[model samples]
Target: MRLSVWRIKYTQRSCSFLRSFHRSFAAAAAAGDDGKGCGPGVSLSDLRRAPACSGPLPALKPTDSHTVLIRTDLLRPGKAPEPHPSPDQLQDRWDDTHVKLPCSEHNLFPTDRTTDQRPSKALSVFLQGLQGSEAQHMFGELLSAMAQLALRAPRLLTQPIPLLRTQRCRSITLSQEQVSCLLANAFFCTFPQRNSHQTEFSNYPDINFSRLFEGSSQTKQEKLKTLLCYFRRVTQQRPTGLITYTRQCLQRLPSWSSSEKQFGKLHISCEGSIEDQGYGMLQVDFANRFVGGGVTGSGLVQEEIRFLINPELIVARLFTEALNDNECLIVTGAEQFSRYSGYSDSFRWEGDHDDQTPRDEWQRRCTEIVAIDALHYSQFLEQFRPENMSRELNKAFCGFVRPGVQPENLSAVATGNWGCGAFGGDKRLKAVLQMMAAAEAERDLMYFTFGDADLVKDCVHVSRLFLVGSVFRLLLQYYECVCKKTTRSRPQKTLYSFLSELL
Candidate 1:
């Protein structure tokens, strides 16, 4: 009897509250902003002007298998994009890497840079804030961009390789001009990559280039010990296993934009260049939001590369001595990176990976090293002689940096557009923007440098780009699978049902 009485009372209270809310809403509707009911019916414009969806809008995903988070409202307009390639296609593309450069090549940068001077301050200082920071890896990003543009000759295949870098929200939102200046000032000095010089890409290493990530097998306990030492920490040997530099990311605050007040305002890049050997130059631009050839905000972000460069016109650098004439040459980390005169690598070049060879050609060859040097934004700036700097810069950026064999249909793809598609309407916007803003900054250089003369050959760039492209392709397939998997609420398995179960 008591329970029944309580229920009746609760129902009555809820009805009464609803009626009160209804009355209040009616009164507000009748009243104008002045609360006098003097104005005509109020328009819903105020609500319309309010921020859309309060918080972030739902992100778009290209497929269900993507491990990254995406927001649909952040989506950009781009191509429908062809389906991602299968593993066989990826393998074929990897096999297509070759040394196709013509023996004869020319200068790719301004002739005047040969006489540049050392700064009163230094490049190390510019990079002090970046060392080991999450942003440090961006050196590879910078190099890859330069090399991809030069060797692939995107215009020939008319391919689009989207370049993606993580930057602060403040930098991207605050000053678009600074973004352009940052890019323009960051001169290409190196292009490093893994297995790029080889005709094939492999996770394993050969006798030529010493492999760091591959070809080294350690026991699980030994691997654990390596990780502990790498992190410079000590931990208990638990019954489970060894522990190392592992931490969970705890996000607490909102992200700011990527523009810097200094770089954006000064409009010059004082960050220093990486020119160490011979030919390659990069042409860059400032952009707003770019999705490139495909949508990025959704599932597996991807873009298309459609350049048409002659295979024989691009040279391939080996990280070690070329195994054969056809084996491409790649320049990775400096044999002995320094801030002064030349450094040596002993009889066998040491460091992250060693390229020990007896041939005279291997003495100072820049092959068999990781391609971080291709366009690395190194902390040290005073090492290379001005001549060597110019030579290295020119070689990596020039069209002839990695001379070797290639198919005439080479192109690229990835996910960084710098908003060229959004700011203006042309694909050549980077080159045009460079002409517009920095052409006069070089004074005499205006006549000397051409877009073709400034490229970096980055092995890291090519490899990462390939990875991104593959991930994107997989995502498209994942999306299709997602659509067909669900009928009402149950999952329907297809032949590819288990593919999405991976990292």
Candidate 2:
């Protein structure tokens, strides 16, 4: 009798949730359906760039490389789209603008092939592997879609260019169509060569979709399903909303020797992910030196999973230099399109996520994240060196500081156990390092332990000690002692222990 009652209640709750979802879905469909020029096809030909012409423009000429246009109406109901320009003709080049049209082809595309234009031999292996698979047809269609969209407006790929000729940070707002176009390039492995073990491209993060097409594992299939889901959603609805990408860099490194005790606010939570809880604030990605790290290679961790869901972030590697220990990368306005459960090897894409976060003045979602790479200690005891700790403090400081922004308006950093899992960093030490850096930067922090109860208690106790008067001064002095080899004992100690003794 009790089981029957429970079943009835569960069914009612499920039905209620589904009804609410249906209402929201219907409202979206209705809003998009209204004939206020919100049709499926965009005005491509009419979007031509204003001419510097005296009379009339010449018609586009046929090129050696064929032009492929993929239309939504052209897709057969049950069959996959046909492939275009055989993989052999791809003849990949780094600087060779992937989109080649008659008018813009010669003017926009670089004529002299430089060293950067050298082709990737590894790409040939991956491309050939996709010969008869479902991925091949899908990839060809995506590439065609990208080419067709870019031909409409050249600025989509040209402006806010990926080279980063200037060192200054830039923030660009892109429509969902623009994002799809960029992601389609990624899907086709059009980016420069990225080999994990090769030293030439080691500094830059892996940005291509090669890995997904390289392996035949179950994981590859699962990842492909999630990616296809995103493609279908964007292609079908054509989101009008905008997303921003802000590239933040620290031009001036903070001084570690300063004893100024500026106390920033902090929040410690035992459960939740940095992405889920840190939606509006600047979330931290325990990243690799090469931004996206092994996300496109063989990696699957906090950083990689973050990239998989917000794939637009992977584009940063094109412009960002390899991160030094004293540097960090901040990305703003990336929308989370999918959600997954589990961490690392256990990660599984659950489904689509509705990013309800409000937009900023720039029409981007108010989501910001900083990618900071912590030092990976191969040996357990190597991280204790005072110099290493100092390096971490500087790295965190670079990430926390919001340039030119007023102190009161700053968003608190959302982070926790940054390098504990993959990098073998001591969790307590990392927490302390982040707190100190935040204090120096005059920003608050929200630390997520991801369901570690013991850490919850430890954080509370340690943070209390950290907030006390003279804690900063004493900590610096202790660091000096360790560096000078002047400590009373050679025994290993927790940061809390050293602070407790001082107290």
Candidate 3:
């Protein structure tokens, strides 16, 4: 056959090619630069004197305009400060006096910062670039704002919350104006850096602003325009309304042995983004343990892209330590500046986003978000392990819990496909886990499956059954009745099919 002849010819040609490659490699190894054969030829002194190995490495130029002084705590070499309450314990230290500080720290920055001392080398570099831009008039003003913020409340940058101590999450209300100032600081790459790698400042990996100014790419240009718009808006007249940033982390892990679960009254739905529908309640940011992940560096995905659109969240990098599995970060008042189409690498900033959320009594916008990091499964099925499930359950319970007698005060949870995209988690499994956690916390659930239509119908069915009994009891009922009936009469049913049977 023609196939047999072609196969013989292909094998013969490949063998000949390999032999030729081997001969070339052997010849190259045998011939030394000194014309010697397969023997050591060059002396250390000769190598040092050679043309290629003769010069000192280029030195970094020091800035002449200002003295660079980076904060010591920001450079804390290893492990983020010991997690508060020692990770295993719970603490409720919230009181009226702790809420005294108004959210907007704009007064922390002044309009005139002409002093010679610069807080960081990064800030100095940023100033140099600002001089060439059309927005030069706002440079001195922005610097003054940065100096006022950094100098007046040096403690804000220095004294991070010692530990994850509070039982109930607290909200820090910041004005749109204050957010603009802080964002402008982050935009210019003012934050201190340990190095380019994620080794040293692991908790703050995406803290620098270097990547924003690196290339002339369209994404970079659009991002720049968005920040420019924010700066211009704030300069014209500082936005009057306030935005809130809430810090959420577990005070203690939830009980796994408890048989009595509280499946409280709830309203659940599945649809578009949590940001668009869950605007008034607490939205979930499926985040990284390091908080911002690589938003300020190279990453551009779920949470990282969110940070890009709302640059104010980048400030959280300055203070948030590395998170424990049970910990989560929450920000309430971040205003989205740019609207984009597509996901990750295909992401394109379409136009400006107008945030019209009304402010509360404290002047903070109704834009609460709880940043919970889901487990990433490299092997896919690893997420099904009992221990991993327990960890996620505790994490979500801590986030959903509201410490108060009144149920009406607690906000419902809005989330979906938490670790399903880049993390490779099963969509069905994560949705079930979120539901179980919400059920235990007695909070309503709102899921956005990111356009998975089938999940919407399945979630509706599962939610109805979930409302009938405790999470465990419902599971027991399904196993006892649903499984028994299905296995004897028909083929083994899938998890979704079994759960939907209860409806």
Candidate 4:
């Protein structure tokens, strides 16, 4: 017997293919055939009953041994300053535990080419802008605020921030003011061992603003405007809310075969975006393993665009280590600051976004973002291997599962065709995998298809037709039949058609 291998390329026809299956299923259901091997579908109204995931914020104080809260008392104005403030006061006391402060003495600013002065051309550009006509009125006030932040860096960030390394479940919570001071130092390129040539922090995402300032592109300029706007706003009025970053590691993997979880309610749509429509839900960041993936450089996509709108998310790079398979980073209280239009190459910074996202019990913004990187495939067919599928299943489970929170308390996940774009993932397969994971985690899902109405209709049909275990079993069969040894080529049928026929 010969098995036919399929190379799954993302194309428009896939949507039509799913539509065909959907039509067939609907016809069978209408004919009173009992929709054999599938269950009654879920409705949008039923799914809405599951409350949006909110509340139960992490304790205001670091209640556990693994959590660290950066104390903010010293940040108060008129607080006694630390004695003997040497010129090298802000210098890095480098070690395994602490983030190397950008304002450190050893981290010299690149001298300007014209005058060989400190504060490289990039930093000078922004500093000069503070004095330019547009900001001339507030120049003195802004300059004083920035100076105060620079002077207080060493005193505020006194505790050694533990690096969120692999397999360690730890959290760091800091006041938004502390975040501002740290970002100010980044704007000045004061962070050490973060240049393109430097490898000291190679495993971590770049945090300094140098990369964002060096290149010249319309997108780059727009990004700078957004970031600069954030700085301006913070300087004028400091934020009092706190933000928390938790690195969660799953110790035991779920047994996908034996799980009997049913699919949760789904709210599928093709019109609105996850950020806008999925507000107050567990927003999913289709992330890169490095976390902030290319936001500091020339890349812009779902993850980067999200980071730009919510610059506070960028600070996660300072301490978050590269994510391992079983690990994910959950961020709560990072406020959004910008709203934009377009995507990737066409991305433009539209203007300021006033984040009125209400605060939780801990005085942190009621925003929760989960970062889970999908596996990138060189060849599209490589994703069909059972191991790869299992990895994806576990990865989504790690992101969706809330350990201490009861199933009823879990917030619904807002996601789209995760890993389907540049990663060349099959939207149909990924949607099923995510639904299954969300089901096992016992949470509803809000799926955004960007603009694929056919996908919206097809997924709604699938959610209505099948149970989680049935779909899981069918997917296993798909791996067994389609992924067996054979020549690699495009398949005549999609996973949708295969399941449709089987059911």
Candidate 5:
């Protein structure tokens, strides 16, 4: 009798979802509903550059790329959008005014011949091996596929202007907690020394563990760059405009303010009002151990990376401020890149997003020991890789996603939408992926992860990389920014100097 009652209750609970399904199946690709102004049979033209003209623009004609999109701008304003300097609105090179390039370098797009484009062989092989359910899946194959895509035909590898320029999560589903967790995981960790005299002086705990990521041995800078790419890409899916740029929040959290320490003690290591709490030590230890494949101490690595980066991430609390998510995350990529490598080369158009955190004052306080040029950056991948670095990236990447985790709420490729509108919720998603797979097989090329890098390099890589580079460069310029806004009578000490030795 009890079993019957429970089963009846369970069925009643799940029936609501059944009612919704009967009303309409959920859209496979949640975002193909671009109905703002686009109509059936209309084709979309390429997105135009932000024009210099003063006149009003025409309505969007429907097509594949520009298809119907709900004008998100129409959504009621949350807060007055913080305005940052956009690249489009910037002053042109002093030399010329007409016939200019969209980004910094004008000579990016190739003009010579169509015959030069060759299919990427490596991508093709890699994608062929991407099949199977999540139970046996590994993500490293996808990374290997992307690395190999770099060598393929420039055309297939190249992307259109706006498409290349910005970084957004490919598919949306990850909540702020997930993005923060990923960032918390990607960070390098540091623990303060335990002195002899004070039996329990410092509250800072030991470092935590980490799941080792497999890849070619890489220099400190390169590791940060590659890791940054993964972090930003993951955040792109289903982006809430609020998270467009994560900002800084240096104010103390009320919870940590209480005198009593609970989950072990935390030390007030670095004095002053800089960081709210000195270090999330025990968690940092877990993070470090995991990154090294569950091993410990790789000689000078911990010192090298710690000195170069902020081994300690501000303790991650479950409190993800809903309204301020975008501002919190806006500058995160830059912050992470700046913290560890000490070679802040990050740059981005600072739009209007701003939080209460006094950014410029807090960042300038730090500095880096070794600075790197472009050519040498790619050469540092040897240390992390045991044999073939690219292959190792493939192995470790796949291993991370290999377990019980499914590629949550992912929608496969859509064929009818090919060079046209999205194929959408119909069973077409599966078919489209098959077609992409088939096309991939024909040329021995693959387009996976965040899609073609070669296409991105010529069209968008310069701008995005510049943004990253600018962030690091700024770190060098104002390590003191990490120190917070200080305007005392005497000159203040440099803050970011914590990175002067190792990296």
Candidate 6:
């Protein structure tokens, strides 16, 4: 069966279940107060860039011990490729912990019944698009450029990529050309051990492109077009900057009960998106613990959409492990290559995007992305537990806090209703949690409600009226009151209503 068919069925069933769950909560709250009371004058415009924060970008040099650089020579512009290494030297570049390259002699591409040792149908179609005068006009001899890309793969990928193992901080930095080459190999379905059901790298997300080509939905077709467009553009003129993926792990969780941080400046809006309006700021990825969350399959949400447009972010799945409670992945310098519209079931690729974001001093794009997965609750009330709330607070702080950087040097965080959709999170509760995290991290925040007018008003009002500690205490009290109720006859107050009535 086609993956999209299964996805549609699964989504329908999920929506049915969610509707029932929502009705239960509604019934419980039917007799409660509306909680529409507003605090002293606060409007959306007043929050826009109020007390903006800016500072020098942190110095980001590649460290030898914890960092791996694929194609080190490519770091400098106009530098020629290094001489091809001997077999022994090549062996030194690989290890059991790193990605096993498809071009390696022991791990060459396998012959299949369909293509018979040639490129697969998907790759053939992509390459065929590079032919003829029209293709030449747009991509500037892309066929030849692809041939050169193939020639440079083995040489450029001499170093083994280290897996960003849990509890260890490590980084992988590669040039744009190197990223393109690796993705080309992935497009050809050349990564070994990635497609098998039981493999040594089962813990990692799938890096091969086989599943992407199997779905029969329009989502798959449009996704392929977007990826092909990325290849065509990059082959036309290779990007010159570097992109870094850093896995950060926090050793100590914050004491939320005693922390005295106040709410930071917030810019709330019902317009624009994180990618469009939050440019140059640290953007949040509402991720799955597995990372890249179903982009390889039919799952299309915030993380998948972001990966489809900027595709370089997808490459992180090659080495990144599943995120832990106190860990997050930070990606710097990925350039957006495609424009897209709608979302999930209604998603459509809207052709090319010319990324004009400036590069930093380290020759990386100024765009920064942080991937943090929120806890998935089976029951809606489960998230209100004190432990789960603390877990989420730490997870957000793990992504937001800049350990080595000074408070004034942190960039404003760009985020929205993170984990509120499929994960069944409450928008008002999550907004307050993120606000507290950003405040503790000493960074300003830009909250995009994605056209939720009520959320904008509620967040603005509450933020204006309370400090971080006050909100934290109130949430604890609210959770206790809700969880202790034993009778269905009693009316239940929502978190926002509880906060409103008291404060």
For candidate 1, lDDT tens digit of each residue in 1-503?
A: 95467446545554543444355345544553542222211222211110221123233233322211112233222211121222123211111222111111222322323212111122233334355753354345533443343332211212111111112010001011111111121122211232233423232122111121222222211221222121111011101110010001112211111111110001111122212111011111111112111111111111111000100001111111222111112221112111121111111111121222111111111211211112222222211222323322232222112223231211110111222232221212222222212111211011111122221111111111112122222323333445334553323442123332432
User: Which numbered prediction scores highest in lDDT against the true structure?
Assistant: 6
Local accuracy of candidate 5 as per-residue lDDT tens digits, 293-363: 11211212322232222221321111112111111211111122223222222312122212222111112
Q: Model 6, which residues run further than 4 Å from truth?
A: 1-65, 68-94, 108-151, 486-491
TM-score of each candidate structure, all chains considered together? 0.15, 0.67, 0.62, 0.82, 0.19, 0.81
Worst 10 residues of 4 by lDDT: 1-10
TM-score comparison, 1 vs 3, better candidate: 3
Backbone clashes (count) for model 4:
4
Lowest lDDT 10-mer window, candidate 3? 42-51
Query: Per-residue lDDT for 137-243 in model 3, tens only?
Result: 54656545544543322323221222222343444434454455455555543433322444334444455466655545455554554455555555555455544
lDDT of 4 by residue, 404-438 (tens): 78776666788999999888888988998999899
**Which residue runs of candidate 4 sit more than 4 Å off their true CA positions?**
1-59, 63-66, 70-93, 103-132, 135-148, 196-200, 485-488
Assess each prediction's global lDDT (C-alpha) against the native.
Answer: 0.21, 0.58, 0.53, 0.72, 0.22, 0.74
lDDT of 2 by residue, 1-503 (tens): 95467446544554543444355335434544442112311122211111111123123222232122222233332232222222223222234223221223333323322211321333344335554764565457754564564343343443323332224454444455556666665665544344344534544555556665665554555565566557656665655444444455566765554444544555677777888866656788888878888766667788888887887677676556677665667776677889888776677879898877765533446677788889998865566665687788888888888666556666667888988986888887788788788877777677888778766656644544333123433454455445245443333665566655544
For model 2, what is the alpha-carbon lDDT of residue 406? 57
Which should have the higher lDDT, number 2 or number 5?
2
* 298-385 per-residue lDDT for model 6 (tens digits): 8888999999899999899888888999999999889999999989988888989988777665577788899999987667777888
RMSD of 4: 7.2
**Cα shift from native, residue 49, model 5 (Å):** 21
